[model samples]
Target: MHAKFEIFAAVAPGLELALRDEALERGFRKAKAAPGGVRFRGTWADVWRANLELRGASKVLARIGQFRVTHLAQLDKLARDFDWTRVMRPDVPVRVEVTCKRSKIYHEGAAAERIERALAEELGAPIDPDAQVVVKARIEDDTCTLSVDTSGELLHKRGHKVAVGKAPMRENMAALFLRQCGFDGQEPVLDPMCGSGTFVIEAAEMAMGLQAGRSRGFAFEQLATFDSNAFDALKSPAEPADLAWNFYGSDRNAGAIEMSAANADRASVGAVTHFRHCGTSEAERPQGPSGLVIVNPPYGGRIGDKKALYALYDALGRTLKQRFKGWRVGIITNEASLAKATGLRFKPTSAPVAHGGIKVTLYQTDAIT
Candidate 1:
């Protein structure tokens, strides 16, 4: 039987091209992009490696089944007919989220009700609205497709950052932003306002050839037919030779520095990055030459403190220009005007990342020529 899997990638909204390239590099030949997700076909091995190595993906889901239905009756039948036992654990509580768009199954409540009923009847698991296993329904153009949320929570909940202080960016988002800045292991990386050290930690981890999934578990393990032996064999080896720590991080807040040190220690990435405390204006470039510098500073958009943030971005821009020449830069935020204050040539790639209810884009700039 040809195994069908859903490999989801983090896209930069208008920059689907970037995401496409990442998918192709992962041995996914027929990669196609959709709104908020990507659909691709691969084998069990592909699924394992994609989950293990693909940095751009937020989650890798196996499309257990999909059906087209026009009426409520068909929706009920489809959910009941799916081999739920093959994928979902009977003991685990599950949640259903439904979306309707240009379809006859227009009632969201009815759709959720039908599926929830099927799962309860078949599995005898009570429906907890905030359960671990989530079943998603999408109705578009008279077709209703059902997918099990394989990675229960986002993959960025990478299990290590228990001491997440300040505004911590997701690991999945940090990885994509690093790729957006052309990180190829050949360049030095830096995050000036490295709160909780997400960017720096991700960079250091990648540089050390560490598996992102090694530190955490996924929803797939709870499902039936999840081969523990297959998955365990894919994990990167723990023992490795010493490598260079080209990634660096700094923050002005003393508490942030302390928190980052602890977070990085838990993450086992102290060998990959150097953490320091310094204001953006007084921050110094690394000892090496040109590399990428990324920062996900607070925009004050969600909290209504944009004025003080403007000063911070201003100081950051001057630091990059004065210390690091011909170095690529990336800034993730919801505020475009705040990013424009940096005075660097920014390519506004609309990032489909929602942090603290703030959907934003990463404004990146090329090296000064």
Candidate 2:
């Protein structure tokens, strides 16, 4: 059997463009973009790089096999046909996640049962959902595609920043949003709404040459062909920096400020970011050339109280136009109406990125134009 491998990097709906761009930069090519992911061809080493390098993906899946199956019997045959001995070992427990869409065999439960049985009987193994070795099954348009999840506990977990504010942004989405905002670590960066300081912490880490996946282990370690010595050699200690956190963030909520500061401190970026209890009305623009400003405020999707949120957006817009000069601005919001409240003339540059179960558009303005 060939070791042909592909990758599925989970992304927000609109953030696929950014993820695709990232994939291309990392030598991954022609990824098929979907609502929540991007699929591309790669190797086990490429999979390792995708997990360690992709800032926008929530997780990475390695495609193992795929075949056409119109019925349960066919699926059974296909499952039995795979080189289970080559892929799955008897000692390792495997979990199967099946998603069926537009297929003749629509019984998802039965499909799971069939795959589970095949793994146990044909492959001689146990089934466990939360185990390290995961096999995901998707039956779409009568095609059965099987993928092994090489990433464990989702790449977004990042294994850092235990401190979080109310309605904190996920790390993967935050990284994608920052990239869409055009942050490249050379300019001053600001996150005025700075809940738990996710954006600021991520930005600081980015600026300091830190890998988002540095702290976690991967499911590949459980694979039969995984190279432990190579990955071990790639591991390096987090470098200590004496540089002050050039990134700045402020929030009207003192509790949020406290939590964000703590998160930054834990992420070893406290020295790279400055936190304060200030709203957009009093938020000071970052010192230096026109830099990027990102804000993830309550957009009525994750946080309740829509009436108050509209007013908040209006205030944010006025604050930017009146206070921030020669500085670009980016806002994360679920709906267009809320973005319009900013009153800045902007064309949507990035597609809708998903956040908190809602697709959010990243709005941008060129230095208050």
Candidate 3:
């Protein structure tokens, strides 16, 4: 195996800064921001740690090596010479994906064929169109860079949340948003419009110091360089702390509440998360110390008609303003008008974040008076 290599932690667009901070805090060496992700360098151990701990990344890619190629002949020659045995297993199958940009050899299909043939013929490894392990080949500016998708499944699949609501928030995005809201796991969290209890469950897990990847398996485990014993050691996190305060969630849909409770139970945070069926106007402040109230309410143009959402936002604003004193709020919405309808005085906004296809921004507030 290579002594050191470059690893890219892929995060959602507009969340590179948050992922960078998470990487640095996790003690990844020289974590720096790139356009779509954070780049760091480490050995295979660092790759395993990143897959297990980083919460903001959707997937992790390890840059095995790169070479400049002007033609398929050069690519074939180089692909055969590279030490594939160091990373890929002869017994397992791999899927190769190629993308070409601004290069003479712009035919991605032909390029992928040549590379796949080289791997199959020279390394004695099988090529399966559907495989858990992926090898990504990008030929940009005449440079052919090969990287392995160390994260087989997406990082957000924590393996516990089997049920999700329509337009549910991803676990990774929820973790980053909680961090953006200055949540240190010390404050209680409330999600008034909790769909599947994503915010409440994530907050409970964070407060308990749970590892994000504790319940799932990763693609890196199939790599040749993967150390099973070392990985087992890394998987042993400290015991989950006993939280004194509980997280709360309420939604108008009974199905959503049932789904939230079931998901929380599967996640092992059911004791600390309470889910109830109620509308935004009927959501009362739970009995607990004032903390953070974060919600991603429905927006028009995607899930509902825009014309009918104003009253919903207005009721949410009125409820928080009149009942939730001393609490801070983070509202995620694509339309500023909807946010303004809440009538909650928001501080200056942060950068717009991309959720699904819509671009949403987080509007935060100081302590509610």
Model 1: lDDT of residue 356: 63
lDDT (Cα, 0-100) at 274 in candidate 3: 95
- TM-score of decoy 3: 0.97
Q: Looking at model 3, how many pairs of residues clash?
A: 0
Give me the candidate number with maximum TM-score. Answer: 3
Residue 45 alpha-carbon offset, candidate 1, angstroms:
4.2
lDDT of 2 by residue, 30-74 (tens): 777766789898777778778887888888988888899999988
Ranked by lDDT, the better of candidates 1 and 2 is 2
How do the residues 1-369 of candidate 3 rate in per-residue lDDT, one tens digit apiece?
448889999988888898899899889979999988999999899998898899888999999989999898889899989899989998889989999999989889889988898889888889999889999999999999999999999999988999999998999999999888888789899999999999999999988877888899999999899989988988866465678788999999999999999999988888889988989988888887999999999998679998899999999999999989999999989999999999999999877888898998888988899
User: Which candidate order results from sorting by lDDT in descending order?
Assistant: 3, 2, 1
TM-score of each: 0.89, 0.91, 0.97
Stretches of candidate 3 exceeding 4 Å from the true structure: 237-240
Expressed as tens digits, the lDDT of each residue in 145-190 for candidate 1 is 7776667667777778877765678787688778767886666788
Query: What RMSD, rounded to one decimal, does every model reach?
Result: 2.6, 2.4, 1.3
* Residue 134, candidate 1: alpha-carbon lDDT: 84
